[model samples]
Every structure is written in structure tokens, then in C-alpha cells.
Target: MAEGRRVKRYADLIKRVVSEVIEFKLNDPNKGMVTLTRVKVSPDLRIATIYYTVLGDEKQRAKTKEVLNRSRSFIRSEIKPFITSRWLPELRFFYDETMDYAERIDSLLKSIKNDADSEEE
Candidate 1:
């Protein structure tokens, strides 16, 4: 329980700081309406992966991801809040597709319901 709490605390801090850095510092026009979804940090607190979603097509998503990755170092340097004892954990950015998957599932279910209703009529 304590272990989980520690990781969660660090993850929350990292997420908040990274989101702020992206929102205020990042000026790349290619960055779409990005939403910082979640952050996962290693138990050893040596690495962190940030999950996010871009409100656009795959091309735009890819572009935003490229911009984010290019600015990873800047973000790391900007987020020096002394939250860690050893280091501020390596940050890795990943495009979260769970939102897309959920939307796909919802559409499929709606179509299935429509098909069932039509068959009944």
C-alpha cells in the first residue's frame, strides 16, 4: 500500500508538471489539442511515461508526438521541482489510444443496436 502510494504521488506530480510545461511553454504549432491522460512511473522512480491524446487525425497526432518528443529535454529541464532524491526520472511520451478505442466500441454498439431494431421492424 505504501509502495503504491509513493508511486502514485510521484506520478501525479509528474503529470501535473508536464502538463503545465506543455500548456505554457510548448509553442509548437503542430501540437494539436493535446490532452494529458495519464502518467506511469517506475517503482524505482527512474523513469516515467506520459500518456496523451491529440484531438486530430493520425497525421496530426504523429506530428504532435514528434514535437513533444523533440521537446522532452526542455520539459525535463523545466520540471526541476526537487521532487526526487536521485533524479527527476526520464520522461517518455506516448500517444494514448484508449480514447479512440472506446469511441470505436461505442460506435460499434450503436450500430449493432440499430441493426437489431431494424430487424425487429
Candidate 2:
């Protein structure tokens, strides 16, 4: 649907804004080395799911999430002026664990490959 495309476009726009504009521009200590992973917007573009990853342990990740949540209002206000949409999508933060899962799978495959090579030898 055309609406879905618009929503996706908005999601990408938000991702770019958060990464290039907010992350780089804002000097927030509590952000904690956060990386914007992905964004998913609803069909109506009223709600957005922003996936992020933080480079640290669980506690640090939690802290970063809290910091981001606290700054949500400010971020919304700051981005509103730039966006031309009638309704700014509500931002929701989620931790992206895909990288960790991929890493584990890669390591397992490497170990299996090493075993195969050893058997061949």
C-alpha cells in the first residue's frame, strides 16, 4: 500500500535523523555509545519502533535505554520542526540483539569448519 511506503520512508528518515543528527550532534553522556540499528514504522506512520544497540554490558545497556527514554520528548520536539509530516511518529526504543546472535552463529560455523579441516588432515 502507498501508506505503508510512506511509513517506511518516515522510519528511514527518523533513523537518519537519530544517527546523523541526534547521536552526532547531541553531547549526551548517558547515551553510552549507542548505535541506531533499525527502524520500523506502522502503516499509518503514527508509531515507530527504533532499534538500537549499546556497546557495553547489560547494566550499561539498561542505563543507555533509560537515558534515551528520558530524552525522547526532547528528541521528538527537536525533530518535529524538520519533518513535514502532519503527525510525527511516536518513537519506541528497542534493543537489537541480532548482531550478537549472528556473531555466535559465525563462531559456531568457524569451529565446525576447523573440525572438518582437522578431520581431513
Candidate 3:
């Protein structure tokens, strides 16, 4: 349906805008290598959840998350010019775990292969 497409488009737009804002506009000394993985916008267009990953340890991830949360208002204001919607969707951030899951799967597969090879020997 057209509504679904609109929501998807909106999510993509929000994702790009947030990524740029975080990459070039955000000014925080405690933030680390924050990477925006994806954005999900509700069908009602009332909430936009942004998922991100930090290329560092748990402490770095936590710090980045804290920074993002603290800067949510600034980010919203920065993207206001680009948003055509009458109401700005609330921004919620979450740490993306897909990368970690993928890495774990890769290691498990490698271990399985190694075990099979050892068994063959």
C-alpha cells in the first residue's frame, strides 16, 4: 500500500539525516566511533527508532549511547528543516546487536569446520 511505502521512505530519510547529523554535526567529546546501522519508523509516523553500533568495548558503547541520548533534542532540531511532516517523530536510540550476532555465528561456523577437519584426520 501507499502508506507502507511512505513509512519506508520516511524511515530511509530519517536514517540518512540522522547519520549525517551524528557524523558531521554532533559535537561531543565522549562519543566514540558511532555507526548508524538502521532506522525504523512507526507506521503512524510518531516514533523513529535509530539503531547504531560503536566500534569499541562495552564502555565505549555505553558512552556513545549516553551521548546519543543526551543529544537527541539537538539531533531532532538539526533534522527539522529536512522533515516535511507536520509533527516531528520522537527519536529513540538502541544499540544494534546484529553485528555481534553475525560475528558469533561466523566463529561458530569456523569452529565447526575445524572440528570436522580434526575428526577427518
Candidate 4:
């Protein structure tokens, strides 16, 4: 489904907050190389799903998630000032696995292409 203008606006707000504000403010050592990929706000704008990715192994990813979970309240507090809405949406953190899936698909496609070329030869 197409995202409405409101959702797009909220997503942009979330992106800015996460990148320019929250990333530096978070003091947790476990929060490794985190990047906010996207945000999905509910239609009513009462809740937001923040999708993020960490540049590290599985262990680091787990640590990053834990740190984010622990720091949720701090993040919300920091974000409140930037948002003009009467009610701030509850933030929910989720790992964006799309990047990993894309990488796997690309690798598989390359392998298939190589095999096809070999068969042709």
C-alpha cells in the first residue's frame, strides 16, 4: 500500500531525530554502528515502528537491540521536543533484515549467472 503524506512526514521526522539527535545522545557501548533505515507510523499516529540496522556480527546486532530497548524512554524524551503533535507516538525498535536479504539475493543471482555462463561455454 502507498504511504500517505502523513506517514511520509512522520518517517522523515523520525529519520532526522534518529540520525541527527538520538545516535549521538545514546551512551550505550553496546549500540554499535546503528543506522535508522526507516520508520512506519500508525495511521492514527499513536505508535511508530523504527527499523534499524547495525554494522556488525550477530552478537553485536543482539547487543545493539538490547541497548536500544533499554534506551527507548530516553529516545522518546529527546524526540518529544522536535515533534509538534499533541501526542507523541510510542516508539518500537525492530531490526531491518531487508539489507541482509538483499545481500543474499544478490550473491545468489551472481552465482546463478556464473553457472549459466559456464554452461554456455
Candidate 5:
């Protein structure tokens, strides 16, 4: 229970700090409206995987991913002051696909509704 709480605390801190860094500190225009979806911290407190979504197509997403991955050290350094841990966890960025899944589901539902309406007509 205590370990869980500690991990949660670290995750939340990492999320907030990383979001701020990406939003204000990183000046790369290629990153394209990057939104950090969530942060997952390893139980051993060694790695923090951050899931993010970009507000563009595949090319833009790829660019953003590349930029983020290249900026890992910078991001980690930015989080250093806020982190209470002795060492910062390894930062890993991954594109979150939840938004795409939700969009597909919504489209299917709308199609089903349209079909039902057409049948009724």
C-alpha cells in the first residue's frame, strides 16, 4: 500500500512537470499540440513511461514522437528539481491510441444509429 502511494505520487508529479515542460519550455514547433495522457511509473521507481497524444496526422505524430524521444534528457533535467527522489527515473514517451479507439467506437455507434433510422423510414 505504501509503495503504491509512493508510486502514485511520483507519477502525478512527473505528469504535471512533464506537461508543463512540454507546453511552455520546449520550443519545438514540430511537437504539434502534444498532450500527455498519462504517466506510468515502474514499481522499482526506475522508469517512467509517459503516454501522449498529438493533434495531427501520422506524420505529425511521428515528428512529435521523435522530438520527445530526443528531448528525454532535457525533460528529465526539467523534472529534476521537482523530484524528491535521489535519481530521476528514465523517461520514455509513447503515443497513446485511446483517442483513436474512442473515435472509431463513436463512428460505429453513429453508423448503427443511422442504419436504424433508415430502416425505420
Candidate 6:
């Protein structure tokens, strides 16, 4: 329970810090309104997986990923002050497809509904 709490706390901190870094600190215009969707921390707090989404297509997302990865060290350094660990955790940025998947499912459901209505008519 304690470990869970610790992990949650750290994950929240990492997410907030990284979000700010990406939004305000990074000078890359190619980031394209990147939004941090979630953050997960290892049990020992040595690794943080940051999930994010871009406000564009696959190419923009790919560029965002590349930009973030390139700026990982800078982001980590910026957030180092907020981390209480003896060593900063390894930051890994990943594209979160949850929103995209949800959108796809929604579109499919709407299509199905339309088909059913037409068939009934």
C-alpha cells in the first residue's frame, strides 16, 4: 500500500513536471500541442514511462516523439529539483493511443447505428 502511494505520488509529479517542460521549456515548434496522458513509475522509482498524445497525424506524432526523446535529458534536468530520489529516473516517452482507439470505436458504433436504422426503415 505504501509503495503504491509512493509510486502514484511520483508518477503525478513526473507527469506534471514533464508536461510543463514540454509545453513551455522546449523550444521545438514541431511538438504540436503535445499532451501528457499518463505517467507510470517503476516500483523502485528508477524509470518513468510518460504517455503523451499529439494534436495531429502520424507524422506530427512521430516528430513530437523524436523531439521529446531528444529533449529527455533537458526535461529530466529541469525536473530534478522536484524529485527527491538519489538518482533521477529514466524517462521514456511513449505515444498514447487510447484516445485514437476510442475515437475509432465511436465512429464504428455510429456507423453500425446508421446501418441498423436504414435497415429498419
| Of 1 and 4, the candidate ranking higher by lDDT | 1
Assess the local accuracy of residue 75 in candidate 4 as a C-alpha lDDT between 0 and 100. 89
lDDT of 4 by residue, 3-87 (tens): 5986789878977896665577987778899999999888878888999999999999999989988888888888888888778
lDDT of 6 by residue, 6-86 (tens): 899989999998899888889998889898999999998999999998898889988998999999999989999999987
Q: Estimate the TM-score of every prediction.
A: 0.95, 0.84, 0.96, 0.90, 0.95, 0.97
The prediction achieving the highest lDDT against the true structure is: 5
- Which digits, one per residue and each the tens of the lDDT, describe model 2 over residues 9-115? 88888998877655766668877888898999887678879999999999998888888888888888777876887888788999999998999999999999999
Give lDDT tens digits, candidate 5, residues 3-22.
99999999999999999999
**Candidate 4 clashing pairs, residues 3+ apart or interchain:** none
lDDT of 1 by residue, 13-118 (tens): 9999899889999988998898899999999998999999988898999899899999999899889874664877888999998989999999999999999999
Better structure of 2 and 4 per TM-score = 4
lDDT of 3 by residue, 30-97 (tens): 88888888899988898999999998999999899899999999999999999999889999999999
Question: Once superposed on the true structure, which residue ranges of model 5 sit more than 4 Å away at CA?
Answer: none
**How close to the true structure is residue 57 of candidate 6, measured as C-alpha lDDT?**
86
- Flag the better candidate by lDDT, 3 or 5: 5
Alpha-carbon RMSD, candidate 5 = 0.9
lDDT for predicted candidate 5 compared with the true structure: 0.94
| Number of backbone collisions per candidate | 0, 0, 0, 0, 0, 0
Q: Candidate 6 has which clashing residue pairs, if any? A: none
Residue 76's lDDT within candidate 5 is 88
